[model samples]
Target chain A: MNRQSLKLSMEIARVHLVSKPKQTIVAMLGVTFGIGMFIALVSLMTGLNNFTEELTMTASPDIHIYQEETSSRKSILEEINPDGLNLVYHQKPKNETTKIRNAREIARLINLDARVLGTSPLVSSQVFYNYGPVQLNGTILGVDILDEDKLFDLRSKMKAGRLEDLLSNHNGLIMGKGLAKKLNVALGDRVVVTTPLGTTITLKILGIFQIGIGVVDNVRSYANISTVQTILQKDQSYITDINVKLKDRNLAPLVASELQSKFIYKSEDWQAANATYLTGSMIRNIITYAVSFTLLIVAGFGIYNILNMTIYNKMKDIAILKAMGFAGVDVKNIFMIQSLVIGFLGGIAGLVIGYGLSFLISKAPFNGGDIISLDHFPVNFDPMYYVVGIVFGVSTTAVAGYMPSRKASKVDPIEILRGQ
Target chain B: MEPILTTKGVNKFFYEPEKFQVLKSIDLTVNKGEFLSLVGKSGCGKSTLMYVLSTMDTDYEGELQIAGQRLTGKSQNELAAFRNAHIGFVFQFHYLLPEFSVLQNVMIPALKLNRYSRKEIEERAMTKLKMLGIDEHARKASSKLSGGQQQRVAIARALINDPDIIMGDEPTGNLDSYNTQLVFDIFSELTHTYKQTIIAVTHDDEFANKSDHRVEMSDGRIVKS
Candidate 1:
């Protein structure tokens, strides 16, 4: 309990561990490997998880507000006649607009909320790309170039030209890499796009980008909002969708519901849109923790076995110490000090090794080949993981060392001295 | 002529083989500076009585007082502290921690007592080792010493804390005649020159006869003193 006895116990523990260098090193190595693997595995797995989540975030908005089509409502004749002959034969459905009314106003109002980050107005249309008799069907999204860039980080994904080019060249279009390849058009080349309403226009290819999703990369392109409006023969107020970004993404659902109720449009959150990806990330996290703990527990068992053996081998020494008036707690502290020293040293070594391995992994070349754009493997270097790793390593060794130390403390000196 | 250790109606039993009594109504008093030997045939309960007197065996029926402190019904930790401060032990096998230097083994009990500074403890340990004539080998591992030298080192360790009483369980059992005589002389010198009280349990007739008081036991009862 006092400082002097603790110092003595530590000294004794040091002698014991030093006397059995082989067993001590072996026990330390178990902890080192367990913690090293834990750090490396967690960093890499979380990095991959972040990458997928980022991809989803870049491809979609935190909340999307759009006009959803509805089925035919009850006829006015049925309301007048009450319960008699409610259905009319061969009734024609009324026409509806695929545009959110007052879209710019809604976007401005949504942006004013403190939780909202930004909003981008978009006009999406189904169109056919025509290049010298090669016709391919695709969807073109017309967006305000600056707002879209701010929302989707589109500037980084550009392969050929900048997003600002779409602003300068009124009729300029930035097509997906796969779409550009299919249409056989390069930058500065013109491609005729035909709208479903039979309106056609020629647009110069200003840039190319890749979204890394095979379907999106093959069938999507972007143009200026005015260009799309001109081709569709609509007026200036022809925004079809409003995409909202939020400061805290977790609030997307709550904000979306509020916006949907307030603006009378269908609002969908990112989590709802990317449920599969969320599930995948959760499962990966669970697997990472499960394997990491298993490794640590196995390492703990190594320490336990070695400490038990050390106690067994030093039975006579323990008996003598007890007879000399070292209390049970003192004997326990001696062995506990050995285990804690091993844990601390091994944990630090493990951190260094883990960092080294992670650095190497981050430098390793990776080729995603058309589906993803990556030059090196992703490895998250979060300091929190190192803290967790070391703490877990030491605590596990402590737990493992406890029982053996207790057994040593309970040794009966009379029995041993009598036997001798 | 002051009584340093006294016991009254002490009774002990062994329950593993069967419920068998080991010590029966033991009543004894050991005076200060007295060199006492407990001698008996094997299983006559001399060693069991020594263990009880040393406060290492507390599962007994009656009162045990050492240096005017009641030792019965006390916790093991308290007893250990008492032993460290008041009673020293020299075992049959000279059970020094093999990994430690001879000096460190000697200094352990004093360090546990923590009544003196580290420098003082070290100096005292060196003086005890010198007294035992093992100071030259004090820095060497205890296991590397010969049996006679190791027994002397154990004796030096027992004297390091300047305990009120020294208890030995066959302290020279494994030694040759020369080492046994050397250990007996050391014990005799400790009690006579330093006024240290000692109780030893042994089978050696010569060792028992030379002590100031020899208590002989038969069938768990003291037959002669």
Candidate 2:
């Protein structure tokens, strides 16, 4: 209320807070903890998601453009559960009964979409291999040999021979290095693969590849589409969906939707195709939000108690100031200043602590195993987090200190003057 | 000389859900450069009247004026500004902020104006502390000083704003006899040298006798002067 008096009060509070070690610690701890927790939680989720997206999109099309559109992953998950991906990887055998009359024409239509930068006819078959008792059931994706290697890095990794071997011979196959080692097979080794639909195909293992990602390393084999169709008894009318690539990974959704409308077909983004991101993020949010709010509640109580004590301890001083021409408004400002000082210090410390811990967590090996297929956790530091944390810290501390500071302002000077 | 402060029929009642009048329609005028002391034992309305005249409490019935400005119904902020520019107060206990140095404590009042340069406020605070013979304590924490020295710091603070009137409520109440005499001499020299108006409340008769005039109070009313 009083400008000059209020300024004096603020100065008084500022000095008191800085000079006292206990008050300074009590005031800032809440702010620091609130901001720190917010930063750590938000950054951790964002970082991990970016990493997963990078790894997924770099190896595959990141997103695949197909000639049919709906909630593909959700409907598949409901229908098949853990085997949901099986439907996506395996195609119906191309027989006289199974092949549609216009399948190649439909694929040709799909190739003409504006966003379809590259479209390869895919003929996929699930094959089972055996050597004594060692067996591995895998899916072989057959695509245009030259186009597939350039559009998908997963097909380019060949541990034993050139990836171009898939194009060199009519019966050539490029199997996963892990799958080759498991079956005790080598280059030029002749092997018989039986499709799930009871068709047998013969192939010479011309090469092997290790995609570095566990998902592709152990469970996939690649061959040219023409060879797969011929061995599986499929005519030109019979083929799986087209594997489409886009120019920009970020604009995959735009391209997916653009092609969907152009060809009247369905497309799948990686989030929908391999949706661990959405599911994992939902679970992480429930945990982080619940835990951070609980910690802030605890910090609130800490600040409230310290502020209450500050009022009680400084009652005499307040009364004295009131008697000496300082206004009640001025007294209130003193307490506010004290809380502000605490928030300032705690904000700095908490940011330092939170970011430091987050940086360490990112480098730590958290994502692994055949399921994760990643070597490191993602840690991304956005400047916005720091700004939000500081503001959050200051506001929370002020709110926690408001009630007691008001009480201090309402003290009666004469009652204290009489030593009451 | 202009009347630095005036209170006409000033009656102050403390209503804690009941009425108990503290000052009974008191009329008082303090002239510039005059040193006046209110002397009384406990249960006297001396301190209550001091708060009233300082413009800290304007809730009383009656008209009060200071330096040509009406005191009643002015907003809290306006009153605070007026108090900063025109009134300085020294309480019995040296209510110094322990975190600030003696010089900083003195500058607190001057800083409220916001017009003075930092250098100017610093010089003013230093100059007053030196005149009070406590210049050596300018940078020392107020809490570290003896009671007498701290009281001198309080006196220096009151003078920093160059207020029109200074009010002291038993300024030597907590000080020893030696510090009491030192504070009294400072008060005497203040009016004699600088022509500063002083209104002090004291329970000490010797301190009251040294004032230019003494107003004695009893039963929550000023009875004799």
Candidate 3:
């Protein structure tokens, strides 16, 4: 706590470190390279994680709200398993219907949330597509074309025609590229679409989109909300689902849970629906941190070995210091301060170098076609990664330096002086 | 005058390899400002006794009182603090920190004692250096100085805190005859003029004979006083 003692100790530490140039630099190199690799690897992994998550989120809505489920036949069957006989039973409930009448009101409430980016009410129905000599069963989605484009990135995925055309023509529809190919239809072509309730309507194909998802591209089509509702005999307010997107995709699960509690709706976030993928990412993060810390500790060992050798080499000096009335803690502080200086400098340099490496990798041009639609390699530039790297680097250095300092403090001054 | 240092029935042993008695039932006392020399042949335990008296070796079975404070059974930190404030040491090796400037080396004990500001310690260190004729080399690294000059710097470092007692273990053993005489003159001046008490362990006969009192030891026991 005394300023003069602290200054004296720091001066001694600085002299020792400066006098032994090779050993000091070598010890510093351990931390430098350790933290460098940590920052670099963590940055790349974080970038890859973001790349993958965005790829997944592009096709999926951030939040999905479905018609609420009350205790029905499924719950009854689960409750009465009938003496553990493992019997398979089926029950149909009269109140279990797909249409939610207040879907627009729920969408309005959700859109009021600052976190919500966009929301759309959708009506889904099983439909049949028929040409001159072919018939295929598929699913049709009723949506407002403009809101659907904002929610699903529909504008960028269009391969033929325009999504805006669907707004002007109520009888027009957009089908996936795979569906268009199967029905032998092109833009401006007419197809007879039959609802499962036996209502047949002829609709012109206004747009073709390919999302690269096998199931959706093969069987899903989109029609104007009013047109699909008329064909399915539903009121204008009825909708089967509400698809919601958030300003921050990471807040989806939180917002979903909030909405689920506040309203009579079943809500799901993209992460919950893809639990396996999230778990895989979580495991990868654990592995990255484990490896980073292990490397830092190894670097710490390098410091430990150097400091231990310094203590041995300077045994006479240590003894003399002790004889001059430097306390054991004072001796220890000299070495501890030395290692901390190394850690601080090394961590800073490592972060700078790592950032340079990340920038270089991100800027590298890629001529090969990307299957995930990324034009170049994806790298995240999150500041949190650097903070983590520095914290781990400095602490590891302090811990590693402590062992040698303790040994130095316990050095017998008389024994060493007499030996000389 | 009251005794500045006292040791009652002191005994010491070394446990390395086997049990071996080093110092046996030693009783010694020195008055304030007295110059006393402990002289003996090799393996006579004179250095061991000095270590016990200096409060550095606590393994001995004895009670040591310095400046009227009980030094026996005290913690290492307490002893170190006590040594810093009251005792100075000059060793044969002139163990100054090689990396530091001579002035810095002299100021270390004062700095550790925390009784003065750094600026005040620096001034005190300069005064000590000037007294030893090493003030001109104060800015130079201790290792860069000549052997005789380094020893002078060591002595200056010892005197920086103005200790009550200056303990020396073969303080002039490594010096040439001329430097040894110079060191003996300094010690004589320190005791005669500055009223500094001295206790030294030495194999040098001339050095022992010049002191005010001599205690001779043989086979771990004091034979003559």
Compute the interface RMSD for candidate 3: 1.1
Single out the weakest 10-residue window by summed lDDT for candidate 3 chain B. Answer: B109-118
DockQ metric for all predictions: 0.86, 0.39, 0.65
Tens digits of per-residue lDDT, candidate 2, A274-339, equal 667568767876787677667666676678788888788877777756655566677888887777
lDDT of 1 by residue, A167-192 (tens): 88888999999889888888888999
User: TM for chain B in all models?
Assistant: 0.98, 0.96, 0.98
lDDT of each: 0.91, 0.76, 0.87
Clashing pairs in 3: A47-A380
Model 3, A309-352: lDDT tens per residue?
Answer: 88898899889888877779888988899999988888888888
User: Who is ahead in TM-score, 2 or 3?
Assistant: 3
Q: Using DockQ, give the best candidate's number.
A: 1
What TM-score does model 3 score on chain A? 0.77
Q: Give the CA lDDT, 0 to 100, for residue A389 in model 3.
A: 84
Considering TM-score, where higher is better, how would the candidates rank from best to worst? Answer: 1, 3, 2
Clashes per model (N, Cα, C within 3 A): 0, 4, 1
